[model samples]
Target: MNHGDTSRERGRRGATAHVDTFARDHLPPPDQWPGLDLDIPTPPGQPGPPGLRHPDRLNCADELLSGPPADRPVFLTPAGPAWTYGELRARVDRIAHLLTGDLGVVPGNRVLLRGPTTPWLAACWLAVLKAGAIAVTVLAQQRPHELATLCDIARVRHALCDVRAVDDLVRAEVPGLRITTYGGDAPDDLLNRPAPEGPYPAVDTAADDVALIAFTSGTTGRPKGCMHFHRDVLAIADTFSRHVLRPRPDDVFAGSPPLGFTFGLGGLVIFPLRAGASALLLEQATPRQLLPAIAEHRVSVLFTAPTAYRTMLDALDGHDVTSLRRCVSAGENLPAATWHAWHERTGLRVINGIGATELLHIFISAADEDIRPGTTGVPVPGWHARVQDEHGDPVPDGEPGLLAVRGPVGCRYLADPRQRVYVRDGWNITGDTYVREPDGYFRYVARADDMIISAGYNIAGPEVEDALLRHPDVVEAAVVGRADRARGQVVVAYAVLKEGAARDAEALRVFMKTELAPYKCPREIVFLDALPRTATGKLQRFRLRGPAYPGGDQQ
Candidate 1:
């Protein structure tokens, strides 16, 4: 299951037996996968500089606070007062000393961090790196079993967590693990603690040395830990900051993503810290709270998902969001209507990007100067993207194919044989299906794994889901291919209606027909109380495809 094993050995050992079996029996032959040529025109310009090459040269605590205004704010929270760069650095230094001297955390040790997003949580993230230990930030919303699995997989020895979440971590029964609890706010006495003497030396880590491990859900039932290095963190900042965000050092960054999710970690911490910009930490980033915080803080840059944007737009009647200069959306596709509505209302275009846990952060994103609505835009600087056929061959232009990427960072799955299916000939095969336009922008299709073949024609699940969502009655929708003997598979829609909405199936079916092509319409509709989702807010499609649904054909 390690990186060194070959595909044949993996198959023989039954390492990924379910995945192998599904691919063998269900997927089209390699030759049948579309071949598309993607020679999209590149915008004229020299590429930006490479991301951090030397890990020692970049320290989040020092690099972010160096040469800052002595009185300027570094972090702010509702429960605690704002701290300046000088104050944050001083607190981080003391915490670093406590971790190194008292807790005995040293370079290369893995420290599991489990807590809600708070000022103390932010400081602990920085202090863990400052102490030269690898920080593994687990989602605070995760169930105990999932947390335990992650602790065991990462071989976490020491942990920093909020007191509320400690019992769950302890219940997981990770062997030989020591846990330390941190209060929600930094105490005044912490700064008086000893600073452990002279300059703290940076760990000598290469671009490939594992610095963080973020787990992502596998196509199968298990989750796979995606390993990243110190350089990858800086690489994301360098690429997205220079080419996509283009933020000034004075810009204020804020977001709703959990600190544990790489999206929030990159947007709220790494990107701003790497660029010497300040981040406002929100203990609660709900739409109600986010709008007021933006106005109160004069935040310039915002990061969130499409759902959040829609919610914010609905709640913006009395709030002043004009100070926000940029808004970035991920975690799901940005519908054209959502994009248009936001722009018509705010005069700011919502930048859309497609990033996966394996790639660390964004690799495909649209810059402000070159945004094409409804497209994922061009590859970020220092990366290359192409559409490949099932045989792993390059595809023709404007044809849907598997998106393959080669860049500063690639994926390495944790002890999973499915790594071979994802990484082929050094290119990371993002399971997304995409078409490259003549203009070089990538238009996202459905996930290859989620495509629906209905009545001898291929249908993308997201396409139908998007159409269904346009209906006023549908609040959320999930489309899956249901097995049918007559047509091989049929499109089925699972929908959650808006509050107090009628659940008349015939009326909804008629509405869908007018919105989408006849072949693309859902053959069956099932009203659901709620759709299951992971802690990170991604839909658990596999759960919908289970025996309870039984091929999706059942109403």
Candidate 2:
């Protein structure tokens, strides 16, 4: 109720009061770490321009249309040849006109996009934005039922899909919706059609207008749509680029995240365009494909998850990656060993951050100069972060608590009461457990929902996973909590060994004991050919918590 405590001391006291009274009984002490300078210059209360004005102007196509024609490539897709910025802009403009004039699409319309990471998908996304319509990019791997639910929730009337997914789209049976197909060797009738000449009127939209709707992993329940405004794109571009990436106009960006995911969108599309740079879009971001794309495109900035980075390093015996200036790892907790290995091999520290679909992008990330390996790093400019207890009170420094954030762009879920659970008193409850050091760096614990209580001692899954990853035999590992009658809940690990490595449970148990506290060590290790993952390649820990694996030991 008393939200006007602008004084730093008063705010800290107020936050502390909330935590001590409500959340302290449920959580652990924050890990002791170095402190941060609280006096660092904070950005303006609301850093970016107020509201989403001229949503039409934020489209990449608009920037391309007004910029000069150059020989430089704007986009390079594996499905087809590259296109210069000038040429890409022209195509986007023509497509935008067709959607608006011929297809009867107008400003504020919701268009569902279902496809792989192809050139056509990228063009359609930009064109939808250019037409002032909200683009909802769904993962291609989603089933028909999932697609139907998403379409209904977003009120999608038009869908742009690839031929491969047309049957699924049809099976979805979305009422009163129209579907269009693209890609393959067939000639595109839309491209050769007459170009829509002269300036089409741009829609006037505020910063708050929903420009895109990104859905989170529906692990707990149905996926919720996280609405991001046009300004949200710029917010990430400004915060991440200024403080973290610092890319130049000439820098070529490349990564493995799909175009639909925020990581890929920010790194491949928005970040590069914001800086007047270029992106080499890969339809298939396999390790083999990605490595060559980087070398062939001379990619300077690389963005991906930690697992991918580890895979790349293992496969990089003769890969030429000298052009790389920066590598960013997110979507999962980054192990310190991964950071050290990358730095040793490439002479670059992988910048680590913790972001969510709700926040639109990374809210707490470190710059190259400020990185502390294994930690998620400090809050970015225009954002405020605090580790708070269960009752929404600030936890003590070095203690783990819910990571709360408030920034220029916050969670605005469409028509969901779950918004109350995430956005409380203007702070976004990130559902992640973290510890803020005295020096300001934040170390990741586990998701509040993922913490395992064994013999009354709370353990974070990632911490154990981080320790296991350091072992020579472990290539990939997932730590999860399994139900145990004796201990309430216990830590269990699913490990995937590197090629030709023998997996011995007894030996691994010894390995973990030597590396971690006895209470934090995995009670059992199950060797698997591969860990189950979401479409985005994130390890699905929920699957491991099954009846078959009771007592944290595999049957």
For lDDT, the strongest prediction is 2
**Shift of residue 384 alpha carbon in model 2, Å:** 1.0
Expressed as tens digits, the lDDT of each residue in 29-49 for candidate 2 is 112111112222334463343
Instruction: State model 2's lDDT.
Output: 0.75
lDDT of 2 at 544: 71
lDDT over C-alpha atoms for residue 186 of model 2: 50
Give the Cα-based TM-score of candidate 2 against the true structure: 0.88
Of candidate 1, the 10-residue stretch with the lowest lDDT total is 14-23
Give per-residue CA lDDT, model 1, range 1-555, as digits (tens).
Answer: 112223332232212112112112322223222121112223468453543444434444445445567677767676667777777776666677887887877666778888877767777777777666778899888777888888877778889888777788888888898887776344423333445764555443433345677888434567787766555677777776666787777888898888888888889887776666778888678777899999988899998887678667667888899889989998878877678878989999999998988888887988666898879888886678889899989888899999998665667665556677777765789899999998889999988889988777989888888788778777678898878889988887899887799999899999988988899998889899787776666677777877676344354
**Please, what is the whole-model Cα lDDT of each candidate in the order they appear?**
0.74, 0.75
Clashes of each: 7, 19
